[model samples]
Target: MNKLLCSILLATSVSFAGLISTTDVTVDGVNTITKNYQFTPNPADLGDLSHDRATAWGISGVSLANGETVTGASLKIENLRNWELNEWNSLFIDLLWWAPEGVTTYKDQNMGYGYGKDDDYFVGKESEFGTVNLTRLNYNVFSGSDGMYANPSEGVTISLDGYKREGFNKIFPLYDVTIDFSDSELATLTSYLNDGNFGLGIDADCHFYNDGFNLSLTTQKTSDVPEPCSLSLMLIGLTSLGGAFVIKKRK
Candidate 1:
């Protein structure tokens, strides 16, 4: 009887044990997803005096088990370039999540979505995740302290020498920007994935010239474990069984 009880307890503990796994979510190809965008300054634009453009990509092929829980997530952007002619010209990059009603891919428009006056640009179609300010556009120097800047309030990190330019006209260089999601953000992302509405929107002012970028997502998931209350009840039941068996043996 003791051996049987121990076996049952061991089996229960194993059943409730949590298993962790990592998943890479990307588009275009497995482990290799990329998107290219070119923003040209509209000299005749009246709104904001700069042309703001937004594009979105929907993530598919995400498969989660029934009891899987997303614990952490991150988004990585590679090879971001800045090619504004004006030295004082800098732009803000806004990361957003497209609403369920929003279009996943470019449609009806030639150059993605253009920002107009007020919040009329986003309205009820998209929600902002965070914003990154690209400062010091004129300086060709490379360093995190001088050339690269990231909004700390947005909970994102910009690596050193993230901005690069070759010769006089080439701004293409290797740099990575990673955004780590908080706990609450992970929960929201999980819900979007479950609904098949997981999409990322990139909105930026017309400062970045023609450039291609690679994007990849890292996600961590944990298998469901038994709740504390349930485990406590199970322990109580097991203790009672042991007590009853001991009493029977004494008799």
Candidate 2:
């Protein structure tokens, strides 16, 4: 019984679900899952977002390896559901290279997002970061201080679909963009530049284990909640009840 409960906990904690709204391109032959960025600078700060300057990041998507392409395909992101990592040892962001490179190896941050910045060209996670290509980019450090996320209240979300016909990031009829984190959450241009890719294929088959990420679950709500054990029990019951149908169906 203990082992069974543990397995249930493991599965519930590690699983993810996504909805596919569009299917223009087959995400099958996907070789690598990476991120691409877009930058559009906003000169005059309107929202008083408290930054030197701000750029909007656009399209910049989560890449899937070749032989892995499909629009509107429901995706699952197990890592982001309820996960935690061991700081530097078990980081949350994946890396493209393993040779201890700089930050320029990936793509540039799309400064197009509208926001506030108080300096000349804002944002930086790594100093010596380089670029990889015109589309994809990487970053250097993974788990240190807010290198690029210094003033996190500034970076804009990557809008794959314009919310209201080019107004804000929205989901269309055949598309459900399930971003792992908040739109404001920084996936800095410098990070992509330093790492080149978002650790898509760096799994067992690949040369390294830099593919997955390790996260620390902060307080999810805006206020207090139940205790950890209490919350865990509630989640267990909910998860079990929720999956009852699927399990029964499989049987």
RMSD of 1: 17.3
RMSD of each: 17.3, 23.6
Q: Report how far off residue 80 is in candidate 1 (Å).
A: 1.8
Among the numbered candidates, top lDDT falls to 1
Cα distance off (Å), candidate 2, residue 106: 21
Candidate no. 1 TM-score = 0.46
Error of 2 at 202 (Å): 30
Show where candidate 1 strays beyond 4 Å. 1-52, 85-123, 126-146, 150-154, 162-175, 209-251
Task: Kindly report which residue pairs in candidate 1 clash with one another.
Answer: none
